[model samples]
Target: MLPAMIDIGVNLTDKRFADDREAVIERAREAGVSRLILTGTSLECSERALALCERFEGQLYFTAGVHPHHASEFGADSQRALESLAAHPACVAIGETGLDFCRNFSTPAEQTAAFERQLELACSTGLPLFLHEREAHSRQLDMLRACRDDFERAVAHCFTGTREELYGYLDLDLHIGITGWICDERRGAHLLPLLRDIPPGRLLLETDAPYLTPRDLRPKPKSGRNEPAYLPHIARRVASETGETEAALRARVLANSEAFFGL
Candidate 1:
C-alpha cells in the first residue's frame, strides 16, 4: 500500500476549487494524501472549511482563526464566533493567524491586536496554532516570545525566509511547515538548505493549495491551480533536500502532522 500522507495546509475553499472541490479531495486520496487540514483565512472561510470537513469527515479537518490580511475586519464578534468554531470536533487548530506586513493589507497595529487575540484563543482552547508570517518576523517573534508559554504549539506555515528567521522559530519550538515554495528555483532555493536544520518531528508538509504551486510541477494544471493531488510531487523534492527517502519523509511527516494538530 502507498504510504499515507497528511497535507497540513490546504485552501480548499478558494474560488479556484469552487466548481470541483470534491474531485480535488478525491484526487488527493488517489495521490496517497490520506488527510488534509483546510485553512480558515476569515470567519466566513473558517465556516466554509469546517463545512467541507463535515462532508469529508474522517479524511479532513480544519483550523479556526483569522488571517492577518483580514485583521481590519476582525471584530469582537469574530472572536466570539471563532471561539465557537474552535470548539467543534473538526477544528484542529486556532489559526490561519499571525502577522503579514509584506502587503500591509492590514496595518501593523491591526494585525498585532488581532494576532494577540487569537493567541489567547489558542491558549483558551488548548489548540495548536496554524501561524503565518511574512516580512514581519521580528515583531511576530517578539510577540510569540512574550506569549509562547501560553499556547500549546504552533506551526510556522509556508516558511520561506532567512536562516535567522528559521532558527528563531525553531528556538521557540515551533514546527516548520514546508510547502511547494521550496520547489521554486528562484525564490525557494534558500529553503532547500534550511530543510536539514529542521529537527526530526518538527518538520511538517503542506500544499497551501491554490497558492504556492510547486513552480516546477510537470504538465502544470491547465488552470494553474494547485491542489492536494500534487503533494507527493512536492514530497519528492523535499526528500532530496533532507537526505531521506520519499517514504521515510512521508512517514515522518504523517506522525508529526497528526501530533501537531491533535489529529
Candidate 2:
C-alpha cells in the first residue's frame, strides 16, 4: 500500500476549485493524501472552509484565522468571530496569520495588531497556530517569541526565508511547513541546503494548492491548477534534496503532521 500523507495546508476555498472541489479531493485521495487541512484566510473563507470540512468529515480539517493580507478587515467583532469558529471540533488551528511586508496589502500596524490578536486567540483556545511570514521576519519573530510560551504549537506555513530566519523560527520551537516553493529552481535553491537543519520531528509538508505547483511535475496539469494530489510529487523532491528515501520522508512528515495538528 502507498504510504499515507497529510497535506497540512490547501486553499480549497479558492474560486478556481469552486466548480469541481469534490473531484479535486477525490484525486488527492487517489494520490495517497489521506487528510487535508483547508486554509481559511478570511472570516467568510473560514466559514466556507468549516462547511467544507463538515461535508468531507474525517478527510478534511480547517484553520480559523485571518491572513495578513486581510489584516485591515479584522475588526471589533473579529476576535469573537474567530473564537466562536475555533470552538468547532473541525477548527484545527488559529491562523494563517502573521506579518507580510513583501506586499503591504495591509499596513504594518494592522498586520501586527491582527497577528497579536490571533496569538491571544491561540493561547486562549489552546489550538495550534498556522502562521505566515514574508519580508517581515524580524518583527514577526519578535512577536512570536514574546508570545510563544502561551500557545501550544505553531508553524510557519509556506516558508521560503533566509538561513537566519529559519534558525530563528526553529529556536522558537515553531514547526516548518514546506510547500512546492522548494521545487522552484530559481527562488527555492537556497532552501535545499537548509533542509538538513530542520530537526526530524519539526518538518511538515503542504501543497498550498492552486498556488505553488511544483515546477518539476511531469506532464504538469494541463490546467496549471494545483491540488492536494501533487503532495507526493513535492515529497519526492524533498527526499531527493534531503538525502532520505521517499518512503522515509513521507512517514516522517505524516507523523509530524499528526502531532502538530493533534490529528
Candidate 3:
C-alpha cells in the first residue's frame, strides 16, 4: 500500500476549526492523511503556526510569510521578523504570499512588494516557496518570471490558472499544487483538462483546509468549513480524471510534496 498523503496548505489558525482542530487532525489521520503543512498569513499567525508545529511535531510543518491582504502592514522590520520565524525548525517554506487581485485587499504595488521580498528571503534561505495567486496570475507570472533567476524552488499553491499560466510556471521549473477547489463541480470542472496535462512528478496536492471543500460529500457545517480529512476526495477526482489508481496518485503526490518541501 502507498504511504498516507500529505496536505501541504492548510490554515489551522482559521476560526472555522476552532471548536474541533484536534478532531479534524485525527479524522485526517484516520483518513490516511499522514501530514499537513499550515500556512502562516502574517507574523502573528506565523508564530502560531510554529506553535502548532511544535504541538504536532513530525506530523505538522509550517510556512512563514504574510498574505497579500496584510501587505500594507509590512515594514522594514517585517522581513526581519519573518526571517526569525522562518528559522524555526518547523518552518518549511516561505509563503502563502503573492498577488490576490481578485479581492484587492492590498494595493497591487504593496502586494508585489511583499511577494518579492518573500521570494528573496526564500531564495536566500534555500527554502521552497508556497505561493498564492488569484485573478493576478498574469502579473504574478510576470513577477516570478522576472525573478526566476533568484528562486531555487516554488509551488503555485491552490493553483487556479490558465493552461498557458500553468505552462508558464512549469517553464520556470516550479511545481503545482492542487486543492479541493479542483473537486468543485461548478467552476472547477474546467480544470479537468489541465489536470490531465500536469505530469505526476510536478504535481502536489493540498486541502487548503477551512476553505475550499470538495463536492460529493455529506453536508458540511452551516458555515461550510473544509478540512484535511476531505483531501482524499481531491485525490479521488484526480485519479479518476487521470485514469490512474488512487494508490498511485496518493504516492506520487506525497513524493512530489516531500521533494518540494524537503519534508
- For each candidate, the alpha-carbon lDDT, in order, equals 0.92, 0.94, 0.87
Clashes of each: 0, 0, 0
lDDT of 3: 0.87
Query: Could you give candidate 2's per-residue lDDT for residues 1-263 as a string of tens digits?
Result: 65799999999999999899999999999999989999999999999999999999999999999999999999999999999999999999988999999999999999999999999999988999999998999999899889878999999999999889999999999999999998889899999989999999999999999999898888889999889999999999889988999999999999999989989
Instruction: Mark the regions of model 2 whose C-alpha exceeds 4 Å error after superposition.
Output: none
Which 10 consecutive positions of candidate 2 have the poorest summed lDDT? 1-10
| Model 1, runs deviating above 4 Å | none
- For every model shown, what is its TM-score relative to the native structure? 0.98, 0.99, 0.96
Better of 2 and 3 by TM-score: 2
lDDT tens string, model 3, 1-263? 65699999999988778888889889999999989999999999889889988999899999999999999988999999999988998889998898898898889999989988998998899888889888888788888888788877999898877889889888888898988777778868778889988877899888888888776666655667788988888898899989999998888888888888888
Candidate 2 colliding pairs: none
Tell me, by lDDT, which candidate is best.
2
Rank by TM-score, highest first.
2, 1, 3
